[model samples]
Target chain A: MEENEMRRVDLVVIGGSAGSFTVLLEILPKIRTDIDFAIVVVLHRKNNFTTSIADVFDQKCALPVLECEDKDRIEKGKIYFAPADYHLLIEKDSCFSLDYSEKVNFSRPAIDITFKNAADVYQSKLVGILLSGANADGAEGLAYIKQKSGTTIVQDPESAEIATMPNEALKLCKPDFIANVGEIADLINQF
Target chain B: MRIYTLVDDDDLETLLNDVANKYGYDFTEYSKASMKRRVNRLCTLDKFASFAELRYRVLNNDSYFARFVEEVTVNVTEMFRDQHFYKTLRDEIIPQLGVHSHIKIWLAGCSTGEEAYSLSILLHEANLAHKAIIYATDINPRVLETARNGIYPIHLIRGYSQNYINSGGITDFSDYYTANYDYARFVDKLREHMIFATHNLVSDSSFNEFQLILCRNVLIYFDKNLQDKVFNLFDASLENLGYLALGSKETIKFSHLERRYQQIGKEKIWRKMK
Candidate 1:
């Protein structure tokens, strides 16, 4: 962490695939609630079928959790999932627009979509977190967040269950924090 | 609560949900204007005076819902509808696509088959169709059926012919289809490499990887966030240095994926980073 740089954010967006569910179970538990920001998880939903991932995550965390719908308002302290097959895009107003469209990178609930949109909408005000994914989905998008001067974090490749995505991101862009999943969550709570 | 006439937005949503549950189709994430127009057309056919009335009817009537689903969700596309995009492909793009030994192209939201057929021709023209696999999908099952049929209203072909010419047609566009009284059944040969199926962009995960994906005209109806989301999906589905094609009016200016692609022309053709 940079001692000199300290600023609050409105929301957080995490992009992951393949091995993401367990990562959530590990990292979200240690986070503090004093920070005012919603956390959205954009994960790969292999089939279009909907699941209660947010609810499942809710059982593991202190914050509220729910699946996002079209035109959903983004509020602080809540955790939103990129509902089953929709791409979770962040509006300029910092709200959400869950869209039905062609799958990107072969995934509808794509990590890159949420990361990139959040980066564009929130810019320096946002924090983009990347974790385990099979493919290099979040690599360029993490680069984009850094380009916009937003904080970017990638789970340490060695700590990740599937490291292709995080490793590729590390290779392509220099993230602000490249840490173990537990450390990433600890930093979030402290931040 | 007594069922009364519903408002436009509410009625449309209700009807869409009804169609989804009964027919396994979902259009909840489609653009409002296009959905409105399509729903209006369906309502008119059902003799409903208002969106609410139409929606009410949809909830109770399976046959009308079937007809409504057919009317509202059809994409009404044909081969080479936008010649300029194809022209860009033939002239500036395809020549540069030789880096990958095998090519995969996905025609996302390929409503009613014209665009897929057009891509088939483009692939054949480029000598890549033989090796390339084209996956064409739509959320609407009826439309997917129509698309799989590879047939179109013959009246629309005259315009398609013009687009073909503008899109760098090297031969007669008519040579691609057999004209029935009112429909044109496209050539069977074009379907050889195509995998036409029902796939929803909003509610489906990607099933394959591709080198080039043409999802033009599909994202313009969505709001900004949705656009970025779909753009990300393209990033996931594509291989490194893959190409993504968006509609004429759409751009990646405000999207997070903007840096992932450089605009080749009117379309937003993207590449996955190496």
Candidate 2:
């Protein structure tokens, strides 16, 4: 085998909305805490609601889960969730940049914004995963990630709580992997 | 297949220094991550091949420099954002400030002056409008001008009205503004008690003392050291036992000033005890 066939993963961005939280609960238990990549999560939330997804996920996941704050440094082995009403963007320096611009696809913490920014910052070392949602927010972003040569994954639309988001992502670009919640965890761990 | 080479962190730092040196605005203390993302965005949007080219344009062009500043600062604000915060301000903080014969309130980093206008409305409800003068300041001159205009897209007014009702607004929210064709202009009376000014929090020193200061969400963009510096500034600028309100996510728990302030209620409002 050629030496560089396996590229190191720097960041794993999981974008979803609606029913993605249930999928997260399914995957978080299986994700190896020792994995060498940072995981940033972007799930849509109501405009002014308080966010507690990190705390909710913390109960099931071994790794620390946090609601991202502006300027929070990205570190491997920890999970970060996009705060409500802010678009979570990845900086070139590998940290979080929160913005309050107008909502996209009717979601403030738009999955597309996070995925596109992560693609720009992490480039080929990134892995973008699109999961269940009611809207098509992450579709263009997943395509952008694929264009940057990053690995892109989509949850099998049949297994999605809401197929619209995953189906839209598949329509926009051919992801490198298509798996259900359990298989997606194994695919991530294989990295 | 194209390779995307990320901008080097050191080179970005150098470019920031160049901008500061030429523009006379210090951005060094701002969080590196957000700054890098914004600069990279500007690079793509402006079609600059490199940060070096960006530095040259920013140094030579005045209008581009203004655009650069706008891109760097965060401008996402809404009327009566964090509705409960406004509710608490009306129920608790305003009553406390009423004890003073005249109130001077400072809204730091008042982007587009939504918070400032929101405060003006609350003051009107509390019968404190006549006695209160709000100094709404931001670093971006463009946003300050927008704040002065007090005009917003009519489409957004519905959500703002809901926020107003949520914040215990007693009167018809529509009474505050006149909606025409595509925009809603806030009543001129609401603009009277407010003064919009350009104030740079990073490099500028405090010039006036206030009975209450609200610096919400703005500090989250700053580094820990810079946050401490601003907290010190707030501490100095606030009158004895004056109130301070931070964004919901922000806290003074770890700051040096934490012990000096006491949390008032469920709200982010705090009273300086010492």
Candidate 3:
């Protein structure tokens, strides 16, 4: 894809597991509040009766943060975290849908499910970022984003807290950029 | 390898229309994202080769259509899911309902009877089992059969036990069921006040008025219009001051019935005011 022909990005999906919390804590606080696209974060988590990840992110992030609910309409300049124990999907009309179907790759909020769904909805206007994790959940989805001519970024495995996730993603498809957490934050600000 | 797309949007529309027109099971109002995923998964699981093949099998074969309905509507559920919600029911809701001479509770979308059994245990513990009658309903009859059996995998018992404890349950959770081989069959006494049946929230009318209605994690699969229709059905069926519960992420706040119901505490349970 040529730089001159790049489509206007409308959605950014970030997938991580294992040691990705520190990365998100560092990156979320740095995200500008005025970005034009909506952001969704998909992280592997246990089903807890209390204390959602969104509540924690809302305190530190510049933009409004929320846990994604069923049929929630996507909005610009906000961040949504996929709720635990359910696969979060993007409908064609840009609303969110939650599913309790069997987990993929031993995960409910599987990065690949959200990534592929978002890719189908946003097509060339999507950006998918895979960060530090111990599993291969996000690799195929990132690769799918690349196949759809959307922007793909993998955290530099050497700099990641755990390299397995990013390394697996790198093995699947060539991402547009491979950078550390700080560099990834900088790239997102430019979007 | 590219993730295959055997079923596209147009294909899904045609399939849903055919099923509704021929079979009267309308899935046109289901959330398309989940529906599409389930349909694609069915294709992969059944090895249909193509979307047209799957459509032909569904449209022509009654047994295959039954399988299709089972696959498309999600039935995954657990006992005492979201411990706090059950805790609220145990500490607050049950005590309030116990004051009534008899309790009628409707468990809509009660898949596999986990929740129905859980409610039975709560009522039994509160000494209200004799006065309570649970109407458990689902769109799929196969799951209703499972619910009626009161048998579940033994491995799930550990989690259910833990959730029961977390939900303020004090009695021996193990006493509720007897483990045989890989399955745990719940005591017959727990199944006494329960009635399991096939009830489609989409097209079915309410059969009885109730003091409490619990339909959790089911509405997420529906679109706004269908949700409103179901809510109206609930509104019509609920008695005055009866409680209506939804999934934790779901709400009645934005709907037309918002003004008629008041949310109790932070839980998704609401009380009808008018």
Candidate 4:
């Protein structure tokens, strides 16, 4: 709930499902307040509306928080959350898309779709971070990022709030770094 | 010599993959069965004694892969292939389309430009050609260049003419083109409002939204998973209430997002639901 300063992330993709909020809280305070890039957080949700995620994320992070919009431009130093009921896609030109037209992995805002598209456009510049979740949605997407020459990080399964998602990702593509909450944020600030 | 005999599915896949990587023409992600049949046929027709022999010949012959791709996924479309769909477009959609000064239509997977030229001809008949923009796209560059040429075997003209008559031709079909020995040259004006480019409907996202989208015949070859992926892309690239037409055998039913569309009927027309 404290104010530090504005920081930019060139592009950060965070994936989680079962217990991601705790992970977010641990990492938010450690990111440098001076960086300038966009951060996209894809957290799984039921078909119901996502009313409180912005409010919750806003309290723990220094950056302004809001759900992404279709055709919305990604600007630096803003924390954009994937709105429920849509899979967020990054265009070739680095704009965002809210595609509710289909569901992948039985979840809208499916992690794989966003990660793959983001990797395609950003390539080696992409940083895909997978956190704790109950499902396998982020596995293929993380693999896509590594295959496309992007950097990857995942929450260490031993210390995760829920280890299923990060563990699934390890089976698919071994990430460049696996760390606990304290170290995860420490590394993100390095970027 | 009887080469290509040990060419099982895996062998066929590897050979095709090698061909694609060496020649820069990708068939790796295409329908497995279709690719299999084509590789088998190409080897048989070219007369190789074994898979090794076939791979050797293919590695040395980049042109063979070029023609192989052309033969496997070639549009094989003639003018007005579906008369009833054309009739529905004219009688139903056009009347309700209102008088827009310019119309933009995307013909996704528009192999060799048959459907693009057909639509152009229809717009010309309706006095809408000068205001129409038809962006026809295919993944194969060779096919795109062929489409740019706008020439077809004169023999195919007879069938196209028949399809034209079946679809309610108002004027003689020959009015659209001139017979030049073995090939027919379509009127240059038909190509004026048209742009043919290489686009992969499967791997590429929809770049621009259009008032109408015609992607027929091609989806039948894709698996259900890929089909659903592409249908979603089409949904994004169509304007609100924009028309989406699929092939006769194709439907939005059972897809992950079928409820977003309103089907026109057995006519193969669909509209984005607001």
Clashes of 2: 0
Residue B58 lDDT (model 4)? 68
For model 2, what is the C-alpha lDDT against the true structure? Answer: 0.86
The weakest ten consecutive residues by lDDT in model 2 chain B span B1-10
Q: How does candidate 1 score on lDDT?
A: 0.73
| Local accuracy of candidate 3 as per-residue lDDT tens digits, B1-274 | 6667689889999999999999999999999988988999899899989988999999999999999999999999999998889999999999899989999999999989999999999999999999999999999999999999999999999999999999998989999999999999999999999999899999999899999999999999998889999999999999999999998788886799999899899999999999
lDDT tens digits, residues A49-130, model 3? 3688998999998799999988889999999999999899998888898988788989989999999888888888999999
In model 3, the clashing pairs are none
Tell me, by TM-score, which candidate is best: 3
The top-ranked prediction according to lDDT is 3
Clashing pairs for predicted structure model 2, backbone only: none
Considering summed lDDT, which 10 consecutive residues are worst modelled in model 1 chain B?
B1-10
- Model 4's i-RMS, to one decimal, reads 14.9
What docking class should model 4 receive?
Answer: incorrect
Candidate scoring better on lDDT of 2 and 4: 2
Estimate the overall C-alpha local distance difference test score of candidate 4.
0.75
Listed in order, the DockQ scores are: 0.01, 0.32, 0.76, 0.01
Q: Write the per-residue lDDT of candidate 2 for residues B67-117, one digit (tens) a residue.
A: 999987788888998888998998989988999998999999999988898
User: DockQ for the candidate 2 complex?
Assistant: 0.32
List residue ranges in candidate 4 displaced over 4 A. A1-191, B1-6, B16-29, B56-61, B98-101
